[model samples]
Target chain A: MSEWWTYRPSDFLLFVPRTYYRLLEHYGAGAWPWQVAALAAGLAVLVALVRGRPGALRLALALLGAGWIAVAWLFLWGRLASIAWSADYAAPAFVAQGALMIVLAALPLRAVDVSKPRRLGASALVASALAYPLLAPAMGRPWAAAEVLLLFPDPTAIATLGLLALLPAGRRAALMIAPLGWCAFQGMTLWTMGAPEAGVLLGAATVALLLPLGRTVRRRRDRAARDRPPASPGA
Target chain B: MPTTLDRRTVAAGFLAGGAAAALPRVARAQAPAPLAKTIPSTEEKIPAVGLGTWITFNVGDDADLRKDCVAVMAAFFEAGGRMIDSSPMYGSAQAVVGAGLEALGSPKPLFAAEKVWTSSDGPAQIEATRKLWGVPRFDLLQVHNLLSWEAHLDTLFAMKDAGKLRYVGVTTSEGRRHGELEKIMAAKPLDFVQLTYNPVDREAEQRLLPLARERGIAVIVNRPFQQGDLTARLEGQPLPALAEPLGATSWAQLILKFIVSHPAVTSAIPATSRVDHVRENLAAAAGPLPDEPTRTKIAAEIVKL
Candidate 1:
């Protein structure tokens, strides 16, 4: 009776990696011309952010919420659940996340202000949104194999992190939690399945999380120092 | 064409025939019965070869794939197979088995086997699984991978005592939890213990097999094909001259036979979605098992490959 830890990594794998990638290819095929659709949506979100209109972030959150719900219904619950049993539980969790986004959109906990645009952060998000679909094709897979932002998961998660990265220090840190968690999750999943892009995803997640977290910690420490009693002169 | 058929083609034909035979009731009765081994705990015998439903039968909500699995079950039973092993952890495997059996009219010979997975939810899971299988009870109920075996064992014992389960057991696979498994086998009263063992992966032979013999627990070998590694290695290789004496026509049969041939083993449940593979697996039970000397020779030759 060896312990569970004695089991090899390959032993936990229920299905081969090929079966998993086949699901991706199938999803790409099912949601064709998704490139145009994702671009249109991304552009709408971009315009709203750029115009800095009243409640622009609100609209963006609503749009993101709709996208998350769509993914939960169309992909997680609909497609993946057909192939993998874990999706039974995971689908509901995704639904909850989408619903949370909707709740956040309806009532403002964090200020919906992107008035002062951070060009670097905004560009990172837009680039991720625009370029994600090309990744699979560039890797030599068919066009039907590309992962789109709204239709596929990896790009969606990556692009979410990029967008959240632009939210300044205070609110961005809170929002980064989900995307960072998702990156860790999706990264491990792809890595276990031997996908080539897993390393890039994990690395991106680390940067996205660490940069914000490091800034937050420095800010908190500085605040504590300032709030403290005047330092003892020579003591 | 001088009545041509190579060994591979012949083997394929034999496998396909196993599937096709399921369509007619008459052909099934005429088929020869597979060899069986008795469960030492209860003296009840089951076919030496059985069906496994791990990744193979978890075709969640895929109608066409589910149909394909149904066809595989048809092939399995048509080939004289009986015991079928599954778990709740394997997604919709138990449900798929229920669906497949319903499609086939529920053969009386089916030795339904399943596992209780949770520490507290053992009874609940068992009840849910029974409803999923559309059956009243299971032939064998095991603690899945010995996950909190002690806590689950209490429920299993009560169930067996209450007549909800015929046999109470525990299982592990891919050589996982062998040391703890050894402790459970020695301390906990069990009727069955499942593990992974194949010609290429013989880690179980050292302690688990010997311990099973001493404790009088029946063994069921899983991953008998190493999840297709063995098949990939021997896909086009011709049947060795040594195989002729044992009446083995395919690599799948040869490997499965090696597993079930062990004196302590009661069955080997190899999962396969293909009807051909199911037939190939069941074919192992139809022939003579290798003796200790022959087993050594076979292992030596297989290692060289």
Candidate 2:
């Protein structure tokens, strides 16, 4: 389970642009990349929270650096002026920022204390709330909904979210249900509006939510095992 | 009396030979007539259908899949097909095709056309394409989708002049840059031009097909079934009664025949992942083509659907 959550943003980013470029070409939209970037960044934060791995943060940063270089190439060398302010442009920027946040979140800012359950719960709630807005627009109606569904939040995001939601305890339930509910609500709204973009956004967000929810469920199971007394001999 | 006897003996010998020749007379047989028109490239006439190696054969590193592809090619060859068009852009298709040919004992393909897809390395691109196909000189070398065509054309023309390549051409699919293709064909001397032309996408018929015919360049039709979209559209629909007279048994045959029946279309290269499809596509070349009126009727039938 822990093994599944670990992934580099760079690995996913390497192939994402190729698909993103194709989508941009197909739909003639400029804003698709921005949603993708925001989704990527949100995913990095989610991974950091679940795994507490500093290396994952570094990998995310490297991916962002490469993604920015690609953006520069497209704008300056390719002379595709539309890409400069396009959603494609915004996507990588969000990814880079998201990766940076993950690094910050992973830093050992204070002494470790296992007994501080209340503080940890409060911090988790605060982090989830803060990350919600960053991940929200990528899930709602308008602009490149189909492409967002097909490409954004990508496979890595889904795997990370699933890992996070698998952690032990009631917190796992909260982590799993909140994102699923948010996605379902967003999806319903998008459907009502006849907005395909909303559906695409919702799909990406659902995948993103799965990683954290999975990790949370897994953590809960582990904590339950540790807390439970050993089985009596011959019982 | 002795001199008279010698003269008489010579006359008797001539008389015997004449008598032997007069025993029976057999009528001389006439020689078989030659083909009305000579094929441009080789003495052997090429079939109107060709094969395309695109996404299907481009599966890389999977040995079992590669073997299946080789079997598909063998089936294609057995069905009396010849030409194969591939590109460097299509992953390992060229390599896979080459391996298939090697596995099948390297039967000589009538025509092999490859494309240079990228910029910045004209010579290296050509070299790599040659190495991948294991052909010393390709029959046709085209500039793929006009990606850096200007730079590649110079190298292609040089290769053609130097006998490194038998023919030089350009290809563009997906209805992209039709005007550019027209401009290049108009200004340049090319032996062939490849483009998409299925029933659904008849946009190429308005200008490109006519221009190729006028320019006397061989035309190769790609995506003859609109990349399976046409097939999906006609799924469960029976072959029209009119297609039987034109000798088309299936939709694949009907579509390929329509593309090849054009006076300018030298061949139509339809990519297929299945051997049955390759055989079916090749069978389109075996019989009489639909006449102009019949073609119009077929088109009308399709449009009505």
Candidate 3:
């Protein structure tokens, strides 16, 4: 048998890139004037988290879970799967992750407090939400072509990572897991399609992973110190 | 993944599929037969071009869209196509095919070919498919993408033995799973193998085509238009002079001819949703196949586009 390799990246593609992006275009158009409402929801989460009130993080987690579930059902299954069968498989994964987020939010874990870095992350996330509606016009795309939070992957990942970053170290790990994994997945998908946001997505995932890792290490060290017997008085 | 070969050898390598026809024929007789070719194993003659339901036939529950699918299937029969290929994984394709067959009175000589896709023993899946296609038996039952090939193969082979299925096969496309597919072809009692092969995507010509020929396995070429990429590229361009004598008029006919005319290829399945597209696609099934030299010429013409 003669040996030759003639595969191209586009050949492996199940859906046309233009067709895939057009779903977001349609979504942006459908959810019109509702962009303000989505932004308001994001602000509510931010305020709730920053206020660090009695029942804030649970409420924030519920809001986050709601976003994930909405995207899983409305965007992935309803919109994307109709065009690409591959998305059908990914839809269930999104639903599972959404459900996981809600469960993690309702649980009572270590008390989470806002730090400066957490504040920065939360502010950046809200800014991303507010900027989403303007993205299409800024990028020279047609009207209602932007990707919004809770309805698209990129902004959802950013928003989730931002919320997870604000939580105290222990709870941060659980919440970040789902969004970080999504970031990693979306990064590769965007890379294959030659989308510009691929690098940004991968970068965000790396940062998200490291943030939780740092907190976990500190928490573990504090426990180690507390558990240790007094450094030998005899010595 | 590059060859250290001259252009002539590369071109000859690609065109070799049109000349490996010494394999046994598995073709069967049909009334009012359209153009047909012999399956390398059973010598049953199937139409040169078949119907593929990858994307076109998977319209889910849309009454208006179902009418168009029915019209497309009707046009397919009118154009002398057989072997409508569907799978459970294709959303509503199997159901759509069933509905189409029903609305059309379950046209005769409809060589039903569907796949079993689950990891579990697929008797239940096969039964479901039978119910969906509304057919007594499938002409061919393949393991889709070779998913759980070992488990499904056991079920498929047993089904074939019991006379529930006419043929047993496996399908893989759009990837370099040839090593595993080739291994299964050698090991299993398979009758057919379907893979992606076209003028531009000619990697199948490398190993799968020759291996199928050597093993006397019928070859079904899927994605003949590279999932409609080649057709889109060839649109608006004048047909190559070579296409006329080979009886290819439009871009779809030209591409389908380049596929079905291959000596080792039992049939090329190019899917379409539009009745006009099916009409154009089935024309190549009856025409003179491109010879080795002509096949090379066609390949060269396509590269320039």
> For each candidate, what's the DockQ?
0.33, 0.02, 0.08
| lDDT, candidates in the order shown | 0.73, 0.58, 0.73
Error of 3 at A151 (Å): 5.7
Output DockQ, candidate 3.
0.08
How do all the candidates rank in terms of DockQ, highest first? Answer: 1, 3, 2
Task: Report the C-alpha lDDT of model 2 over B193-223, residue by residue, as the tens digit.
Answer: 8998866678888999899878767788887
2 versus 3: better lDDT goes to:
3
Which docking band does candidate 2 fall into?
Answer: incorrect
lDDT of 1: 0.73
DockQ of 1: 0.33
Which sections of candidate 3 miss by over 4 Å? A1-39, A46-58, A70-121, A130-155, A186-235, B1-34, B59-68, B186-189, B203-211, B232-239
| TM-score of each candidate structure, all chains considered together | 0.79, 0.58, 0.72
Model 2 lDDT, residue B282, Cα:
74
Lowest-lDDT window of 10 residues in candidate 3 chain B?
Answer: B19-28
Best by DockQ: 1
The model with the greatest TM-score is 1
| Interface RMSD, every prediction, one decimal place | 3.4, 17.6, 6.3
lDDT of 2 at B118: 67
